[model samples]
Target: MWVFWALLAAISAALVIVLTKAGLKNIDSSLAFAIQSVMILVITWGVVFFQGNFHEWRAIEKNAWVFLIAAGVFTTLSTLFSYKALSQGPASVVVTLERSSLVIAIILSVIFLKEKLTWQVIVGGSVMIAGAVLISLSNSRD
Candidate 1:
């Protein structure tokens, strides 16, 4: 089930990259991101309200709130940077570089979340970063 959800998220992200690139042709990346952020806020809150989870926010602990707020800030930064990159570069190249975050996420997960670090994960992340670098370099030559 988790794998299914992950795959769905991946697909949705792909769509977002393509659609956002197309939409940014005439718009400033920051403005485009802001427009999309508004939609995200509305849709997410709508879901929470529909599910009767809007009041659950009061139950969140201080630490959880801190982490969530920090995550939100980082998420905004990440999206803004990605949008700027996408506006200036090819989608394929920008996305490949952005996907390198997987390696950083794995490292942080192991250190902060106490997640198991397997050889396969290490090798896979290394290969992924290498591939992203290769793709980015190749794009630069063209």
Candidate 2:
């Protein structure tokens, strides 16, 4: 189930990069993302209400609220940077670079969440990092 959702997210993310790049051709990155943020906020809450989960929101714990708030802040920052990058570069390369954040997330999980990292995980992450760097350097040469 998780893999299905993750794959859908990946597909949507690709579409977002392509669509945002088109929309941002003449707009400031910040403004473009701000418009998107508004839409997301409305749609998210609308779904919650439609699904009758609005009441469940009150059941969320204090710690969960804190974490969700922090996540929202970081998500905004991350998205702003992504929009800026997308505005300045090809979406494929920009998204490839953005995917490097996975490595950082893995490292943070290991240090803060006490998640164990196997050699395979380390190798896979290193390969992803190398791929992003190589794509970047290749573009610079042209």
Candidate 3:
């Protein structure tokens, strides 16, 4: 079930990249990101309300709130930078580069979360980074 959800999210992210690239053609990236952020806020809060989970917000611990807020800050920065990149470059190249953040996430998870690292993760991250670099370089030549 988690795999299914992750796959769906991956597909949605791919669509977002293409759609955002198209939408950024006639507008500033920051403005485009702001419009998208509004929709994100509405939909996420709507989900919480629909699920009757709004009240759970009050139950969150101080440490959890701090981490959540930090995550939100990073998410905003990541999206803004992604939008700016998409506006200035080919979607394929931009998305490949952005998705390479998976490597960073893997490293951070192992170090910060004390997660176990396996050979598969190491090989996969290396390949992914290589692919992103290749795509970025290929785009530069064109």
Candidate 4:
């Protein structure tokens, strides 16, 4: 079940990158991000309401609020940078680099989140990072 959810998240994130890049070609990145953020906020809040978790929101402490805000800012910056990179580079290269965030996430999860990296994760992450490097350097001469 957890693996299914993780796979779904990966697929969904890829779709988001492709769709966002296509959308950004015509619209301003900030405008696109604003629209996306609004829709996500509405849908998430709606789900919270449906789950009867609205009341629990009141118990969220100031530190939680700060963390949430920081997360939002980080997400916003990520989107902006992605859009900018997409605008400047080939979509294939941009998408590949964007997906490299998985490597960053794994590293951060180990460092800050105190997550243990099993041998499988080490091997998988190494392969992925190698692939990214290959993709980045392979076409440089062309």
Pick the TM-score winner. Answer: 3
Q: Over the stretch 1-142, how does candidate 1's per-residue lDDT look in tens digits? A: 9999999999999999999999999899999999999999999999999998888888999999999999999999999999999999999999999999999999999999999999999999999999998998999999
Q: TM-scores for all candidates?
A: 0.97, 0.94, 0.98, 0.84
Q: Which candidate has the top score in lDDT? A: 1
Question: What's the true lDDT of residue 101 in model 3?
Answer: 90
- Which pairs clash in the backbone of model 3? none
lDDT (10s digit) by residue, model 2, range 1-142 = 9999999999999899999999997899999999998999999999989998888877999999999999999999999999999999988789999999999999999999999999999999999999999999888776
Off by over 4 Å in 1: none
Give stretches of model 2 more than 4 Å off: none
Q: Between which residue pairs do clashes occur in model 1?
A: none
lDDT scores of the candidates, listed in order: 0.96, 0.94, 0.94, 0.84
Root-mean-square deviation per candidate: 0.8, 1.1, 0.7, 2.0
Clashes of each: 0, 0, 0, 0
lDDT of 3: 0.94
lDDT of 3 by residue, 42-121 (tens): 99999989998888888999999999999999999999999999999899999999998999999999999999999999
Query: What C-alpha lDDT does candidate 1 achieve relative to the native structure?
Result: 0.96
Backbone steric clashes in candidate 4, count: 0
